[model samples]
Target: MSRKTLIPIGPYHPLQEEPELFKLYCDGEIVTDIKWETGYNHRGIEKLSESKSYDQVFFLVERICGICSTSHPFAFANAVEEIVAVEITDRAKYIRSIIGELERIHSHLLWVGLAGHFLGYNTVFMWAWKYREPVLDLFEMITGNRNSYAMFKVGGVRRDIENSKIPAIRKEIAVIRKKIDLLTGAVMDDPVIHARTKGVGILTRQDIIDYGAVGPTARASGVDIDVRRDDPYAAYPLVNWKVITAQAGDVFAKAEVRLLEMYESASIIEQCIDALEKMKEGDITLKINEIPEGLGTGRAEAPRGEVFHFVVSDGSNSPARHKIRAPSYTNIATFKKSCIGQTIADATLSLAAVDPCYCCTERMAAAYDNSSGKKILNANELIALSLKRTSELRKSGTGHE
Candidate 1:
């Protein structure tokens, strides 16, 4: 008897931190097809950016993803800076890179803890999250907020990493490096973990390329694309750090890439810290009177992958148009490639392997009149609605007029 069943894990599942629906069509234990839904978390952030000043847009974009908060601001700053044609101080460069790398370490640790919990390995979860606290503490010490550091701005950073603080930061980094070593060893060497993740949900290099996956998802499949190295930005070009990759493209391979990348991130942070030690602080931001009419594209490699921001300036305080493409936008699409043919039990882990950020991946696709149950807004209509709302806010003296 060929019996098929549909199993759904989402829209409000416990496995995911946010609401995303993943539908699995399975025959017995093997998943035959998979489909996922978004739009449940859309907030129209790009449209909102047009109403805020260039300086304020950094804060707006930073909330795109809590884990990749700084990542968005870093890219946004790069975009606006491109429009302004301004160069930030070298000291600011090092501080920016240090903050970026620290966020990478903390974000990877968060993913590792969540991955452990998903696999029913509570001890690994405990160890991973416990060590992650120190990294968050480092963020608090430097930027005051553990998640959304708000350290970025156009042309430069908001805060300078003082030379006096480098020693303490290095001490914390050393402790974190030791903890990472232990966690990496345990995960890499555990026979149970190997059995659960090694061959499960394997994605070939072609799959990664076809899906246009980024970050660890693509790197795990042997794709050597990194914005930090390929499209050099901020202090990444000044620092020496190699991209970490794995050949398997499986769940274990993804884990391997993230773990090894943490080491690379730490190394990059140390080098940046050393550079910061030789420079004097206080040259953090560059004053820009205005952003001239131009279009600029910026790319930053977040903990998951490349975060791209495009800004169009119309010689105004606010952006004429703002567009964002987070790494998860493409990475989430890979669930179709990795989850199909996977066992139902392995499908969720495969989905989680990419560390998809639902909030970062959503956009308002369509709108309807709920009362009439009829489509009322298409893409153009949605844009008009956005513009209209911005105009209303401006008229009310709430937006940058």
Candidate 2:
């Protein structure tokens, strides 16, 4: 008989979220069922935003998640704009896009590196972090803060991209793009990664629709949905770019989608820079003192997924009600479908394939052998086991081996 064992991931640890607990039901080597517990680190940013005025809300929402710092503010800004029916300046539009894309680059690199780490790939961890520094440097140069970039406001962007810096920024992006291509090839084309990730954690297209999954999680399942394209915002309409999707709906598919998307993000920023170069470095924002009595909803295609913000105003400076929905909220649910039927060795990477933030921030895992009541593997050790499984499967020329 296959004994039922519960693998507890974390309650205060990081895997895809800030702090969440997951209990995976395993029957020997195969994960039979999974249930998760969350809400470990809730700062109540939504409730706090109600007390702050529209202008002040930007700073508060940016702290929702350090990785998604811009995403929150970007969505909040859009919600505010919708309520007042305010149209921002053209320069501000492109600036917002540039900043948003830069955020995407850094956030994706963080995920790729961390995912690599969870798979026993230290070189990927080092190189990914190394290349990510320039993106932060660019953010620091533009927004004065690398992580909590307080660039997006209700009316427009807070800062303008200097015309003189365009040449340098493009140079940096070109170099980084080349490195990303190399890294992407290393992971995507490699047979071992395929052996480890392919056909694992398969989330069908219907599963995505059922769970309301977004971003790479859904895109990896071959779902054609992106807030940037389906619902155009900022400079997305002006720039030419394609949304990347994969049919396999496995860990490798998720990796391919993200890796390919980075190139598109870089290209979007390049296009934005070109647009910025032609225009004068004019007003970045148009300040609004009051918000009218209306409900506003806005969404931005965040790095991990879609960041949706809802604001209720009663002609007051502060919001009457503030609701924030990070992609992690929806993306986490899909794990129920993806995790089951996967081996204990594949559970860690399967969870990682979704890349949760607000839901997935750090990697944490625990493997318990139910029959003997012995906790067996740590997160990295699980990766080692997965790697070993890969080796065995590759060497024997059969999965049964």
Q: Model 2, which residues run further than 4 Å from truth?
A: 13-17, 359-401
lDDT of 2 by residue, 93-181 (tens): 99999989998999899889988887878788898999899898888888888788888777887777889989989998898898888
Q: After superposition, how far is residue 302 of candidate 2 from its true place, in Å?
A: 0.6
lDDT of 1 at 378: 93
Tell me the TM-score of each prediction against the true structure.
0.95, 0.87
At residue 263, give the lDDT of candidate 2.
96
Worst 10 residues of 1 by lDDT: 392-401
Give one digit per residue, the lDDT tens place, for model 1 in 222-274: 99999999988889999888999999999999999999999999999999988
Query: Per model, how many backbone clashes are there?
Result: 1, 11
Candidate 1: C-alpha RMSD after superposition: 2.2
Clashing pairs in 1: 11-20
Q: Global CA lDDT of candidate 2, please?
A: 0.85
Residue 5's lDDT within candidate 1 is 94
